[model samples]
Target: MPVNLPEIESMELYPVAGVKLGWAQGHIKKANRKDVLVIELCEGASVAGVFTLNRFCAAPVTLCRQHLAGNKGIRALVVNTGCANAGTGEQGMLDAKKTCNAVAELLAIPQDAVLPFSTGVILENLPMDRLLAALPNAVNNLAEDNWKDAAYSIMTTDVAPKAVSEQLNIAGKQVVVTGISKGAGMIHPNMATMLGYLATDAGIEQSLLTEITKEIADLSFNCISVDGDTSTNDSFIIIASGQSEVQFNSREQAGFAELYQSLLASAQKLAQAIVRDGEGATKFMSVNVHGAKTMAEAKAVGFAIGKSPLVKTAFFASDPNLGRILAAIGYAARECDSLNDLDTNLIDLYLGDVLVADKGGLAKSYKEADGQNIMNRAEIDMTVKLNRGDVDVTIWTCDFSYEYVRINADYRS
Candidate 1:
C-alpha cells in the first residue's frame, strides 16, 4: 500500500485556460484501462521539457527532443501507456513519429508541433494498431476539466493519480497552474519512470521557460529515489499558454517571482506525491543533510542513505540498525568528488526528533525504543548534520517491503 497518500475522490484540481485533456481506452497492454491521452494547447503556448539521462532512452523521448528543437511552436501532446517502445531499433522511432504525425493531422497543425511520450514495459514494441485506432476517441473527447482522468490515463505501475493546482494574484489578475505526474517504481534521481506535465496561464519567454525547467527538475524530480533504478522514458514538461494578463520576458520582470514560486510549489507537491505512492511502500522518509560545503555533497550523502538497500530494509522492519546509515554516509563522502575529507566526529544524526548518533558513535542518551518508535510511523524524517559547510538538501524516499519484491517478481506475469 502507498504510504500516507490521499484519496483521489478528495482532490479538487483547477484547469489551465488554454489546455484541454482527453483520454481513451486504447488497451495498449491491458483491457478497459484509460491508456491513451491527448493534451491540446492553444495557439501561443510556449513549452519546455527535460528528459531522462539514460543513454538508451525510449523512442518517443528521442522524437520529443527533435520536435522541440525544430521550434515549430508545439500545439499538442500525445501519450500512451503500457508499452515503452524502447530497444526496438528503427521501427520504434518510426512508430513514435507516426504518433506525432497523426495527432498533428487531427489537430490541423504541423507534424513537428506535437510531442509524444510513452511508459510501461521496456524493450517491447508499442501496440500501434490499438493505439492508432483509439486516437479519434481521445481527440474528440477533449475538454478543459479532465485533469483527473488525464492523470489516470498515464499510469503504468502507479497506485494513485498524482495531480495538483495552484493559483496566485499577479498585478491584480489571477494566474493558474495545474500539473500531473505518475510513477511507482524504477524511480531515482536524474528523472525517473515518470511523466509530468505542468501548464500555466501566465506567459513566460521561451528561453526563460527552458532555464526554469532545468532548475525545477533539479529541485523536484531530481530529489526523489525509490528502488534506486532510473527508467528510459522519463519526461517533465512545462507549458505556458500566455492566456492571462501576467506575462514576463525575464526573471527580473514583475510577477515572475510570484508565478514561478507557485509553479515550483505545484511541482514539489506533485513530485512528493510520487514518492508517497511508491510501490509497496509502507513508510515515507525524508532524508535531510545539512552543513555541507555544496548542494552536490549534501545530495550525495542523502542519496547514499536513501538508496542503500540495507538502510531501506532496516526502516521497513522497524529496526534501529544505525550503523548502515553511517556506513552509507562514509562511502558517499569518499565517492563524491565535490567533498573533501568528512569528519564524522562533528556529525549528528537524528531519527525523527530523537538524537540517535553523534561523535563518531552512538549517543550516550540514545535509546533503541526511541528509534524503533519513529521507524514505525507512516512518515519519518532522518536529519543529518554534516557539520562540514552550510548547504542543506532534502531527498524523499520510501522503505522496501516484502511486497516490493513480490510485485517485481511477478511484474511480467
Candidate 2:
C-alpha cells in the first residue's frame, strides 16, 4: 500500500513533439506483464543523464556512459525489467550491447546512439532471444501518448506507476514537460536512483541541458532514500527535443527560468512519489536539516535521519522517540569523515513546529502529547537546526514497516 499517495486516474501525460514510447512483454522473468520499454527520440534532440555511483554498476550503465560520451546524440532508449544485466561479468556487457544493437538496427540509427537499461533480479543474464524478438513489436507500437504505459512498464516493486506532467509558456509558446520514475526500495541514489526520464519540448543548448540535468537531479532524485541501499542500475535522463521553437541562448533568457522551474517541480513530484510508494512504507516524511556550513553537510545530516532504521520504525509506530533522532544525527555527523565538527549543544530539533530537543537535550517546553500528535499524521515534517551556518537541505523518506521486511525477504520468489 502506498502512503498518502493518490492514483493518477486520468494520467494527463503530455506529449513532447519529438518523443515516442512503447512497451512489450518479453517474458524475461514473468509472464503476461509488459516488461520492456522503448523511447524513440527525434534526430535533433539533446540528451543528458546522471547514473548511479555504485562501483558494481550494471552493464547498461557502462554502455550508457559510452554512448553519451560519443556525443553522437541519443536516438533511442531500450529498457527491460525482470532481469537486471548486472554482476554477469563480460556476458552482461555483451547482452546490453546486443540489445542496443537490435534497437539501433530496427530504428535505422547508429548503434552508438542507442542506450539500454535494465532492472529487477541481479546477477543474471538478459534473455537475449526474447528481448531481441520483442524489439520489432515495441517499435511498431510506438506512440506519442504512451507515457502511462511506459510508466507502468518500468515498474519493478512499485505499487503504482509514477509520472508527472507540466506545461508553461516559454516565449509565448506552450512548453510541455513530462516525466516518469520508478523505485520502491534500494533507493539511496548517489547520482540518481531507480530510473527517471524527463523530457521538455523547449529548445535549449546541449551543454545547458547537461548542466541542468545534474542540477535538478541533486535537488530531486538525489535527495530521497527508501532502503538506503543503492542499486547497480540507477539512472536519470533528461531530453530536450527543441520542438517548441522557443530558443534560448543562455540562462538569462526570459523563458528559461520558468522552464527550469517547471522541469524541477515535475522531477521533484516524481521523486517524492517513489518515497510515498516505498516498499512497505506507511508514512511519508520530510527530513530537513538547516544551519550547516555547506549544502553537502546539510544533506548528509538529513540523509542520516532519513536512513536510520530506529527512527523509521519510531515513525511507523507513531512513537515520539526523540533520542533515536538525536542519536542518528550524531552518527551521521561522525560519518561525514570531517573533523569532529558537530556540536550537540548548539543543535535544536522539531517535530513539525513543536520543539522537542534544544541545547542537546529535551527542550524546556517539550511535551510528549505534542510530539505524538504530529507523529500520528500520515505525513510528517522533521526539522533539525545546527546553529552553525546558513545552509539547509531536505530529504524525503518513508517509515519502515513489517511489509517492507516481508517484501524483501521473499522478493525473489
Candidate 3:
C-alpha cells in the first residue's frame, strides 16, 4: 500500500520567469536510461546550496561547493547519474571541470557559471564522451513546463521521481516554489546522498536567497535518515529568479516569512517522499524525542535510536522490541553523559501500554499481540521522553528488510 500525499500530486508549478528548463539522456552509465539532467538558470539569478559533509566527498561536490561559494550568479546546473566523479583523485577533478566546460560551451554560458553533480558508483571514471554527445539534444529540448520529465531523468535506484510545488501569497500576489529531489538509499543525517534542485519565481536579494536556503535545508534534508550512510556526492541547490513581480524586503516585509515557510514545507515534502520510496522500506517511521537537556542531546538520541540496526530490524519484523529501543537510548545517552537514575528508571515501553520493558529489563506484562498491532501501521510514531529538560526534536527513518540487501547487492548492475 503506497502512502499517497495529495500535496505532491496536486502541486502546481508556475513557469520559471526567465529560465528555460531542459534535460538529456546521456549514456553516462550502463543503465541505458536518461542519465543526465540540465536546468539552465536565468542570468543573474541568485544561487544557494548545501553539500555533503563527507570528508571523502566526490569531485562534483567539491567543485559545486567552490562554485557556490564564489557567489557569482550561476547560469546552469548539469548533473549525471552514472559516475559520482568521486574517489578518482586529480583525474576526477579534471573530469568534473571538463563536464562543466562542455555544458558551458553547449549552452553558451561561461564554465564558471556551470555546476556539475554526479551520482552513481564511486571511484569509477565518468564516460565523458557519452555525456558530451547528449548535450545538443538536451539543449534543443529545453522547456519551462518539463520539470516532471527532468525529475525522472536524473533518477538511479529511485522507483519514481520526487518533486513538489507550493503557492505562496506575497503582497497579495501569488509566488511559486517548485523543487525536485533524487535519493533512494545511502541516506542519513549530516547530509544524505540526495541531490535536490529548488526553483522559485519570486524576486529577492541574493543574500536573502542564500539565507533562506541554508535555513530550509537544515530543517528538511538535515533532519531525515534512511540508512545512516552519507554518500560521497550529495548536493542541493536553490535558484530564485525574480520572474514574479513580488519583491521581498528582508527587513520590513512579513511576507518573507510566509515564503520561507512555504519553501521549507516543499523541501520537507520532497524529503519525506524520498523516505517513502526508500529501497526495501515497508513502513515509514518518525521518532520524536522530547524533555531532553538540549536540542543537541535530543537529536543525538533521536538519530541513535533511528539508526539502530536492532530497531530497524524490529521494524522489519513488525515486532515492538522494546528492549532494543531502550538499549539504543541508553547507549546514545551515554555518549552525551546525559543519563541519570530517573532517566534510567523512568523510561517505560508501552507496547500500547503492555509495559513490555521497564527500569532496563523485560516486563512480565509484555504481550506479543500488542507488539504486532503497533507494527501493522504504515506510519509508526515512536516517542522518547528524556525526563530531564524541555528540549526536543524529531527524526524520520524507515524499516529495513531483505529486499534492501537485494537492491544494494546488485546496485551497480
Lowest summed lDDT across 10 adjacent residues in model 3 is found at 1-10
Residue 194 displacement (Å), model 1: 0.8
**Total clashes, candidate 2?**
0
- Report how far residue 76 has shifted in candidate 1, in Å: 0.7
Please list the residue runs of candidate 1 whose C-alpha ends up more than 4 Å from where it truly belongs after superposition: 9-11
Error of 2 at 150 (Å): 0.4
TM-score of 2: 0.98
The TM-score values for the models, in the order shown, are: 0.98, 0.98, 0.92
Off by over 4 Å in 3: 1-12, 249-252, 334-342, 348-368
Query: What is candidate 2's lDDT per residue for 1-413, written digit by digit as tens?
Result: 89877676334888888999989988888888888999999988999999999999999999999999999989999999988899999999999999989998899999999989999999989999999988898999899899999998999989999999888876677999999999998989685459999998887888898899999999999999988899999999998988887876689888789988998999899999999999999999999898988887888889889989999999999999879999988887565755167899999999999999988889999999999999999999999999889998889999999999999998889
lDDT of 1: 0.90
Clashing residue pairs in candidate 1 are none
